[model samples]
Target: MDPLLLQVLAAKQIPSIGDDAMLLQESMVELINSNPKAGWKAALPSRFSNYTIGQFKYMLGMKKIPKDASLSFPVGSHVANSNLPAQFDARTAWPQCSSIGRILDQGHCGSCWAFGAVECLTDRFCIQLDVTISLSVNDILSCCGSSCGDGCKGGWLINAWQYFVQNGVVTEECDPYFDPVGCRHPGCTEVWQTPQCVQKCKSENQVWSDQKHFGVSAFNIQSDPQSIMAEIYTNGPVEAGFAIYQDFPLYESGVYKHVSGKLIGHHAVKLIGWGTTEEGEDYWLAANSWNSGWGDNGFFKIKRGTNECEFEENVVAGMPSPKNLNSALSGGRE
Candidate 1:
């Protein structure tokens, strides 16, 4: 073992981790040594260096779309993308929105569900109005109601989207990331508890903050490649959920496809676009919240069409009212 590798394991307390860490490391090392044609490198990156698949679940933390929410709205038929271009990215469609290459870190909270929905909403809202404004993932995570799940214990992207339709999220300035209570906070998880809605925007001084944000509507995409792609082309990006594997944390870069890891847990993310690799492999670009230090600078590309990790199964999207954009234009944060 390399002394540096041991140091990382020690610093991260990996020695006393779950049963799969050692196995994942062994597999990754052997595969890398073999030098396959894959574009990305794999190893136990810091994000998954010390944690097991079970603990990783907290980071992914995406619950199922509530039956009521899914059924409330009549299902829309899957739209075909046959007429669409072979390649389309929200980043290029509306550069004015400035949503391209945007990544977010959820810190220690299992609020991927909130981050995904809010991120998509933020992008679409910005694209729709052609402006730049950072919406509040903290607001969504803390106050979206029980319907979104145990407030960071893991929630559904669909639930979060619906909540946004009823009541959208504020900006990061209004309610910053509340790691102490909003989530597990990176190094600790022994005292797991569901946090309550803090409603920080309601502060006496920022009394007008609550009125600055609004959710206009929400919808779900059909579980088909064309449907997913068409949704991305039409909007900005869509919130997606899929099962993750132990090998995911080690992803360095490239079009990722499950090679050797086993079932870890379900995670939610923002699906940006699709592309075929130089080697002709198809992939879906996604934004992750594990910070810029991990994965492809806080983003990852997974195999496309096959739903490599179910990235297309539970897709959700949202709309923000023009009222929110007006507030943003006026510098909503007084």
Candidate 2:
């Protein structure tokens, strides 16, 4: 065991044998459970234990850019209120939209950037238009080209939203996700190639252009807690990009805060709602693309209000075009 590794584990209160503190060695799980201050539960998830910290970090693929002046949206009075609930979950709020609760895996790619955007957009279509449709994440990942970023390797959220307005994306039923079961099993590495862009639909009956859905506008929200709550409360869910630390993958339950481990990488997830714990810690309920096997059944509660991991700073979303929806409902393509 390296002396520095021991020091880090002690400082983080995670019992370890001089390895990456975030790596789920068997000893760390017992140490994690005994340490009350650690706040979250740790498990040697057999799926996660298969890879080293470096390999696991490669699984994250959200590449963020500076906030554009033209892209920010004002927190409208539609959702503004002083009496916001202490806890709110989008799944509970919009039970009619099954997509709100559905979790998808990004697989062996760093396509979380695309997953976060489409997941939120899929929920928003149901929430805003009273129309239930699962948007295709693959459409953005494979086809958006250099404008969206290098597909699979990573992507830009704003560019994705813009692509929705400019080029549009097909339904999940048309294209579907590329690698649904790739990254979950043991021995998986950074081998997910950027899927080739295909303009055609998978189904014989669905025309690629007719299956396309569009966004009205792309924009960012105010980073304040109330503003974020108002956005999710009014608009369903929003995509949030944040700095991920090593202790993140070990998160099983409780309001997560950076406890131990090095800065791994930046990743994105969908912020579905907000809440406070029984212990009175405030948190944002988020859905990850790492599949349900990881953390609280594919969801996580992270420290809110304080902008832990800068989660609040990079929130972005857009509205589904009602014209496109109306056209689709009327059996026409706009």
Candidate 3:
């Protein structure tokens, strides 16, 4: 079946929340309930659960209007043009000795785009400057302005990067703000403003063009997503996109096993590591944005190479080609 039609059919099967916030909360509950060994065993109020469910539904494009929905990335934008080759493995593409950090949860806000962009920047920052700084997603989510989305709504990853380049990001604690509230540093105290954020490229004269010139790398993954996952885990967390499974069973205990397709929404996660299931299907260890209570200590593993779980290959297309960045910034081809 066509993926879009299949997604619509699957969305109709899930329960509905009155609004987006409630929808996301519900999804978190389902995610936690799906994983029993993680030890989370508390039930949430219907109101709270509804928020998660709503967000999930809206993200999947099931809702006629989003509770806090905003603009999305341009259509056809992705990191890869194809799926990974069948022979790839996690050990080869990623460096072994890289340093990764703990996973984070964005919680109720469609700030995954910011989280993804910041996670990538943090990794590169660590590699380039030899310092591990957990930069603030709140900063970008709060400050990037209308081109992305409001704090309550969704945003674009490229816009977040532009925000980062124009205004250097600070530690989460330094700015320590949240959505609905935004940046609270009192003027530009903790903010680092680069000319890149709002500056249009001289040649292309596009806001996004300036972002292309920044030092970001993109790759296409096929075969073993575990390897790319490992690279993300070892180097630092990577922003990954996933299709939300609606029928993803509820977390009555904390164990999740796919029963049928009820998945909805397109979510971005931080890849932390990888492990094998009892059935020997490889799963990618991911950090969710649903607070610490969800998943295996705010983490979950998706079966690799099945469904749209292998969408990591598409991430390559979202990356700014090094060659493109150079040419745009240098006024000519490198």
Candidate 4:
């Protein structure tokens, strides 16, 4: 084993499986659970047992930008905090919109930038226009090209939203995500090449153009907790990009804080709501794209108000177009 790799395992307090075995979930769980002060629980998820340290790094693919990058999208609006609730959840607020609670898997791809955007937009369409549609994350990942980013390698969160407004995205029914190795399958660490952009839908009956949905506008929300809460309270869920630390993959439940480990990479998720834990820790609820088997059933709560993990910064969202919705139903005349 490389001495550097051994040092990393030592730093994480993970026992060596000997020889070339990298970090294993079992050792990580043992190390975490043994600590009485560890706020969150850890588990040995069999599905991720074979994941090497390198693969874990690639699993998260949300790119980072300068602090001033928010200027590109700008704050869409501000809301008064006078009536803000102590707790809120998008799933509860929009009970009819099943998309709000859906837990999607990026499936061995670093297309979290695309998954985060499409997931939030799918919920927004249901909340805004009362239309239920699973927008295609694949369309954004494979089709947006350089305008979005290097496909599964990583991408900008802002560009994903911008693509929704300018180019629009088709329904999942039209171009569903390609997952050959199911997310639940163990030892699935193969990185996928982005699928080629297919202009047409898989179902011959549905026209790709007619199945498309457009956004009216794309904007960022002020990083302040009140502002982010108000935006989701009124419009729906928003896409939040933040840095991921090595400790994050071990998260089970509790308001996550960077207790230990090094910076792994950046990742994006659907910022769905906020709440206060029984221990009085403030947290922002988010939906991750690692499927239901990870974290708190594909959901996580990170430290809120303080911008822990930089989750509050660079929040992005958009409005669905009623005009485009009607046009799609009639014909491709938008």
Candidate 5:
């Protein structure tokens, strides 16, 4: 690895504010600018050749990429409506979300579906149940079965929620799992203990109730994504979708100027809040699990309103409130 790249990675391991981290990231970018090929050689090896400097920098904190890195789609495919209410301004809405807490990213795995499902589950779980519990993505990743393939390839978020409904999830600790190796073990420490439903909900002609122990709803965004994002931030963390730019330029600080790049895949990230830059451009505050080093201490902002970074408008899945129960069946979207 290039000595300078190694230094940047080392500095990231320590906890720091997003602004400071951005500053260091800029310094690293400058180092690479001076020697492009050498820097690419050091920061991006074969395993990382598919990623740009920014993408590779983000991956340094993760153990490995999930299997579906090449299969993600951009958010532009599902924009439905665009009429905005008077109060909805990207500039203000972005900062509001950022102020609340740090955002998170889910890296290259299709486990994004898992993270997305769980984040909304956790947030709503806290609000509805009055309990602050970090539901286990590890449990879903480990036990949802072979039908969903291995964690790396990809799985539907709805399927994960269905698994949770029937099999009442255990704490993440009991499972201690990760993606690309979905549920490698059998026999959970705590068995899902609940009554079986004699009859399922018929709303969607599906055997499972629309009111399964946990349920998620999908929606389409027509206008400014920031408006919907504001709703999610106020309500709690939401599972928002985005296109992964493999070639996002790596800079230590300042606003991210757009560049053409490959659309590697789609990902689910936790929407903590929104914020704006000194110049008043809008952005959504996101959290990434790639570790604390990547993007503003495991967090970063996506441009709002450009249609490039629109998230909430493309509602992939909205988890319904979970009931206290045990064991649900697993299958793809109906």
Candidate 6:
């Protein structure tokens, strides 16, 4: 084994595996050795270099999805004008860049659905209201009812957005991640938990009168590149779910596709924009909740329109309400 690869294994505390680990190692080595001309580059050795395929899948967060497949098509309010840019990047799109500098971590919990929804919700609300209230992921995870799945045990993005629009989500100051008590607290390295959902506000004090910030509407986008782009370009950052493959974790930069590694599970992410690479490969720029240490400084670009990893299959977006009081959103024309 390469010394650096061995070092990464030790650093990540990769568990010893039987034949399965060996097989995964060989597959990774083969991909590295072959060096296909794929647009993205995989790591020669990274945190996941020594992990078994099963181990890789375990690290992936997403699982079940909602059975309901209906999406509000023609997305009445978000029809982009002829002036829509062929290429757009929400991260730098002037006032539309509500999600910039706000990358979040789901900790060790499988709360990607919550994180993705709230982060995008926060951005959408901020863009619509010009406010900076950080929405609570914990609230959605704990209070979204039985159908939204168990807290930190994984859930559906559709249910998450639906909950946000209907019930509203409180600020981070209200719920504050995992509360350090739930076994699901990602920072609780020694203890893993299913987490009991309990809503808290300001050290148990009522700094504000309300329990949540809210939006007037939320909807799923058509499973196509054009609709995905129009939704984000018109609304703000949108939430999406994609299948996670073994090769996904090692992504360093550039447009990503399944170059190696087997499929693990699904993952939720925030879709910010779309652009064609200099190589003419179309890609979707998204923000992941795995922290800045993960990929492309906490963000990633994936092959677009190809339904790579089943990404475009389940795109969702929502509209934030005007100011805490009431103001009007221009592009979000309702």
TM-score of each: 0.83, 0.88, 0.54, 0.89, 0.53, 0.79
lDDT of 3 by residue, 86-199 (tens): 333223333441423445545444566667666666555555444444556665666666755554356644456555545545445344435323222233211222112322
What lDDT does the true structure give each of the candidates? 0.69, 0.79, 0.45, 0.80, 0.43, 0.67
Judging by lDDT against the true structure, name the best candidate: 4
How would you encode candidate 2's per-residue C-alpha lDDT over 1-334 as one tens digit per residue? 3435544775676433332334565555565566677678877665576666666777778787755643454333235678889889999999999998998888878888999999998899899988888889889999998988888778877788889889888888788887767576554566658878887778666677877788888887777888888888888899999998666887888888776656778898999999888888899999998888889998999999998999988888888886556545543432
Q: Which stretches of candidate 4 lie over 4 Å from their true place?
A: 1-21, 25-27, 184-189, 330-334
Off by over 4 Å in 2: 1-22, 27-31, 67-80, 185-188, 326-334
**Predicted candidate 6 versus true structure: per-residue lDDT over 1-334, tens digit per residue:** 4535544643344334442553245445445335545567655334333445544443345555544545433242445457668688776774544455567766556788888888988887667667766778878877885667656667777778778767777777666876434223335431234455565464555332264677777676777777777777776788888898656777778898775545567789888888888878988999987667667887889998789989988787777764333211111112
Ranking by lDDT: 4, 2, 1, 6, 3, 5
Those runs of model 1 whose alpha carbons end farther than 4 Å from true positions after fitting are: 1-24, 32-39, 66-79, 180-195, 202-205, 208-211, 324-334
**Candidates sorted by TM-score, descending order?**
4, 2, 1, 6, 3, 5
Q: Residue 328, candidate 3: how far off, in angstroms?
A: 26
lDDT tens string, model 5, 1-334? 5546644653554333331123123334444444423212112222232333433333221112233641342221233334433233322444433322433334343466667666666565555444444455555655565533345445554455556555545433333333323222242111212112233232333333322345433332224665455445344555566565433323223333333233334555666555566667766666655445544555556666665533534443344444543222232115
Candidate 2 collision pairs: none
lDDT of candidate 1 over 1-334, digit per residue (tens): 4535533543353233464444346545445434454456775566555565555666768887655657775343455557867666777777776655677667556888888887887787777766567777777787776777877678877778778767766776666666623223454662344456677554445534544466677777777888888778876788889887665777888887665445667888888888887888888888887777778788888888886777777887766677655664555455
lDDT of 4 by residue, 210-240 (tens): 8789988888787888989999999999999
Cα miss at 72, model 1 (Å)?
4.1
lDDT of 1 at 139: 79
- Residue 272 lDDT (model 1): 85
**Model 5: per-residue Cα lDDT at residue 327:** 27
How does model 1 score by TM-score?
A: 0.83
Which is superior by lDDT, 3 or 4? 4
Q: Number of clashes in every candidate structure?
A: 0, 0, 49, 0, 42, 1
